[model samples]
Target: MESSSELADIKMVLAALMQGMNDTKGKAQVVEPKQEKPSAESEGVEGEEDVDIVQHETNAEEDKGDEGGLATYMKMHQDFYASLHYTRVQEMCKQKNIQYFRKDMGAWELARLDLQEYKDMLKGGKP
Candidate 1:
């Protein structure tokens, strides 16, 4: 039961609303590129400066990721292998009558050694 004039007014309001929504959407898109978001996807490399910045960001992310337990485990494995004092452990094992198993050492071997004893061994403590 609406009049023709009322129908025209409704159409105009709807058109204005649609145009406003489009304008807001366009402005949002224009504003968004002011802050960059990093993605793991392939990036468009323009030149060295951009490339270095991207790489630095990526590396920072990697360092953050490396704070997880897997990184700790990996570091422990490396240290245990690299800095393990085998001869000291063997002598300490002998002194303490601990079981000795060579070539079957790693995580278990590191875990079995006491903290004090390990530190002592690191300091080249005599059995």
Candidate 2:
């Protein structure tokens, strides 16, 4: 009977996790590239290599995000944050005066807060 109750609790936890994962999966909007009409100067051009347009598009998006703010920077560098140890993240957060849950928060979350704090300091804010 206790085993069955434990299984039910696990199921509830799994359901909540799934919901959170789905919520975090935001749809990225794609910007359409403007197509230019072929000019007579390029009509006879041949043997040129085709560019990876998608790569260029994403680079431009990253550049735009850099100018936007910390949220975008955090998203772009999640892997870097995740790689840090929890203790280091907590220390950095403390040094920067970034509010974080000492026991509940993981390394990546603390690291993100630390990064935002650093960026805010760079921008002359007191975060």
Candidate 3:
């Protein structure tokens, strides 16, 4: 049989080990969560601002191209309509060889002009 003193020492060792484990767990609980850095793509505005910026840049480029000639502006307008899947609008513009003015126009104004042209085409008149 083992001595009582040895049993006491074993119990003390086990208790110390358990206490150390508890201390480690406590320290882990106190640790703060790591923070994430912002990515370049995610640094801009959420939804509307992103749309606005894109539209603004496109409009600025289109206006610069428009200053060259009506033919250039008309090509841009047709390309823009094609991208939006307005096949009838594209066909009509191509068949009629319509002239378009794209200078200094915002998104809303451009959209309005496109709609008006579409209506005019439907009515069998030149836009």
Candidate 4:
């Protein structure tokens, strides 16, 4: 037969083991609430349209040089033209509704007349 002290010690060990298991289970339950999966939109695939819009806006800036008078000037000046940075030139073009082009000159030649008049008027001549 086991001694009373030994039996008491065994009971104490078993009780501690049960308490440890319960603590682990409680911690697991607390952690479960924090492990949620991200929503589809947050993953980006569901927001493809937004991604496309952003891409289109970005591409529009690049394509602006392929459209209007500026494109013609750029073509004519392709070798000697002052290097106009894309953003600054793009802003000017946007504000003036000037078409940007890579090679076409018809519109730019016409626009040059206005610039010449402005310069002439600035110099005290009738535009």
Best by TM-score: 2
Query: Which ranking of candidates, highest lDDT first?
Result: 2, 1, 3, 4
Candidate 2 clash pair list: none
For model 2 the TM-score comes to: 0.31
What is the lDDT, from 0 to 100, of the residue 100 in candidate 3? 34
Instruction: List the candidates' TM-scores in order.
Output: 0.26, 0.31, 0.18, 0.23
lDDT of 1 at 87: 76
Encode model 2's per-residue lDDT on 25-82: one tens digit a residue.
4666777999999898777675676667667335777677677557666765565655
10 residues in a row with least lDDT, candidate 4? 102-111
RMSD of 3: 19.8
Better of 1 and 4 by lDDT: 1
lDDT of 3 by residue, 1-127 (tens): 4688899999999999887774654465566878888678787744534344354335777677655355454557645654553454544444555443432233224545665575567568645
lDDT of 4: 0.55
Better of 1 and 2 by TM-score: 2
Off by over 4 Å in 3: 1-27, 47-127
Error of 4 at 51 (Å): 72
Predicted structure 4: clash tally: 5
Q: Please provide, for model 1 over 34-98, each residue's C-alpha lDDT reduced to its tens digit, 9 standing for 90 to 100.
A: 65765545355433353343543346777778653445665565466436577765665567666
Q: Lowest-scoring 10 consecutive residues by lDDT in candidate 3?
A: 99-108
Local distance difference test, candidate 2: 0.68
